[model samples]
Target: MQHLRVAWALAGAAAGFFLLFLIQAHLFGEGQLVAGTCEIVTLDRDSSQPRRTIARQTARCACRKGQIAGTTRASPACVDAQIVRSRQWCEMMPCLDDEGCDLLVNRTGWTCAQPGGRVKTTTVS
Candidate 1:
């Protein structure tokens, strides 16, 4: 009957709307996503003394969803090293200019200092 058809259409519309809301809530909710900071440090090696300090900076880290594809190794996104890990025993490279220095970002998200300042921190996808 006409009335039966109308009722079915209304029910379908309501169900569609409810499903959309649930999906959006799961995707956009803040708690569902994780974000954090990373620091990188660069060290100098050539100095007369054994120990030297170089530069430092911070970057942002976020959690992503995916399964490991091929090997036992985890995805880079999940286990990327911070700056500190890279510089633990590395020597420092000379600065490019007064404001420049040889540096890299560590797993912690910090960069070694350059002549002018530390490298700017940023986020990657």
Candidate 2:
């Protein structure tokens, strides 16, 4: 029957749409796919920081400490309460073997990169 085939096609299309909606909901949480009216904002990142790992946050302190890489839905955290209170500077030579470190003016600097990279060093006043 011609009408029977049309009904079967319509049923398949409905099932496909339902599955798609369910997948989107599972990936982005419920009601996130609703049009407009979302609370998202960009964060303040250091100008010198790499652009490869930058993200926005929906709320304050939504990410873990020292997370420089994240998605648009989540924000990255840099430094926790304990670390900020202690005022402890991160160690130098964070690179593994085959990587070079830039000591610059201070023995404990935070600039490290691959070998043969341009580095800056100036004497303290």
Candidate 3:
């Protein structure tokens, strides 16, 4: 009976630790980070090949209200006023090796997908 009790206690503690880990990921995952690169590629629009990169700007965190991780928003994420940077990524067709680039949330942003439709990160910016 004592051995069984010890086993149960250990199991319970492990479960508790796993639960906390999940909660932390939800509240402060990489998605919540106010950082990402934005690029402007020169797409042929009619071609099914890789596009050329024309312009790129160093971006700053410009998250909207309540976009930060965790329950508390310590400071608002703002962008540089002097620079005109894209708010989202993949503004043009940048997919390579016959991959596809699909826009998200309408035509606001875009992402590269493999032939199997799985998203693959080709470039950070």
Candidate 4:
């Protein structure tokens, strides 16, 4: 009977440890799994803004056959392709004196210095 009790206790402890391990794996392992590159082909359009957010900026990677990763904005006649490998935004800047600029997959905020003591904010989408 004593042997049975010890065996049961050991089994319960093992099960508990396995459950904790699974929980930790689920929380931390999933995020690490999603890191990789994304290859995309940009569609040509006459409009200044690209169709998608990823289409607006150049990705960071080696260009092959006239296709590069860093062609973020393309001309209406230029059909650009890129691969965005990283999840973080490529660039970030201030929109204005008081506004904060953040560049994301779909939106890019720009702050340009004017001739005078003024700054211009431009949002590229």
Candidate 5:
């Protein structure tokens, strides 16, 4: 019947639109950019010579997925996102009430210090 044909056509159009929406979302979903502060170290380069450190600088950066603002041994820089995630703590709120959390030097781990003089240290594996 004519009504049945029109209903089928409408259903097909709706399905097509849904499929298009999904494809668009999949392609653009990971395009988010994150902003952070990073350190920059400038080096003096000479031909046939080792690079020498010139100055340490800081900058605000907008990094895309898979990259993060972090610091290197020599200076602040944009590093792999995984490294940032592994090095960061206290942001995860692992400390309890009446406790203070601090990120360890070199970002090797974190420590939670309680007001009672008890401390818990967690190292990154």
Candidate 6:
């Protein structure tokens, strides 16, 4: 009957909407995902001696669904997926075998310096 078909369609629509809502809630909910801890080592430059001391540090970070844990200059925190994929400082192997990649000072980009003194820079948002 026409009424029976209409009821089934309405039920199917409602189920689809519910499924969508559940998926959104699972991804965007308040609960955060732990990306894990990271250990960092650096040179301590403030010392008066000519030789720098090695400074060791650890950081525990939590990131959202699309992010991963990373260390910024100031602290440990979440980093965007695109930045990780881009693999700054030659991690992505963007340059030729003989060339080198250097992370820019601003931390928003990188430069591939060639043997001929040519520099190619790419910026990420």
Using TM-score as the measure, the top candidate is 3
Residues 1-125, candidate 3: write the lDDT tens digits: 99999999999999999999999998987644434322222323233446533332233343444342110111122433221144343333345656666546644445677777567433233
Lowest summed-lDDT stretch of 10 residues in model 5? 49-58
Q: Write the per-residue lDDT of candidate 4 for residues 3-119, one digit (tens) a residue.
A: 999999999999999999999998887424222223444443345555423224323343345432332322111123332223222232223344433344354544445456454
Worst 10 residues of 3 by lDDT: 68-77
Query: How accurate locally, in lDDT, is each candidate?
Result: 0.38, 0.42, 0.45, 0.42, 0.62, 0.61
What's the lDDT of the predicted structure labeled candidate 5? Answer: 0.62
* Residue pairs of candidate 6 with colliding backbone atoms: none
Score candidate 3 by lDDT. Answer: 0.45
Q: By TM-score, how accurate is candidate 3?
A: 0.34
- Give the per-residue lDDT digits (tens) of candidate 2, residues 20-77: 9999889999445233123344554334665343233342333344432211211123
lDDT of 6 by residue, 1-125 (tens): 99999999999999999999999998987544445433333433245545433234444466667766554433455666676776563454545666677888876766668898877665554
> How does model 6 fare in lDDT?
0.61
- Which digits, one per residue and each the tens of the lDDT, describe model 1 over residues 1-125? 99999999999999999999999988886544244222223333344544443333232345333321110111122232332234321222222233333333542222335554445321222
Best by lDDT: 5
TM-score: the better of candidates 1 and 3: 3
**Tens digit of per-residue lDDT, candidate 5, span 10-68:** 99999999999999888766543345444333444334544432232344556656776
TM-score of 2: 0.30
Candidates 1 and 5, the one with greater TM-score: 5
Candidates in order, TM-scores: namely 0.32, 0.30, 0.34, 0.30, 0.33, 0.31
Q: Kindly give the stretch of ten consecutive residues in candidate 6 with the minimal lDDT sum.
A: 37-46
Query: How big is the positional error of residue 29 in model 1, measured in Å on the Cα after superposition?
Result: 3.1
Off by over 4 Å in 3: 34-53, 56-125
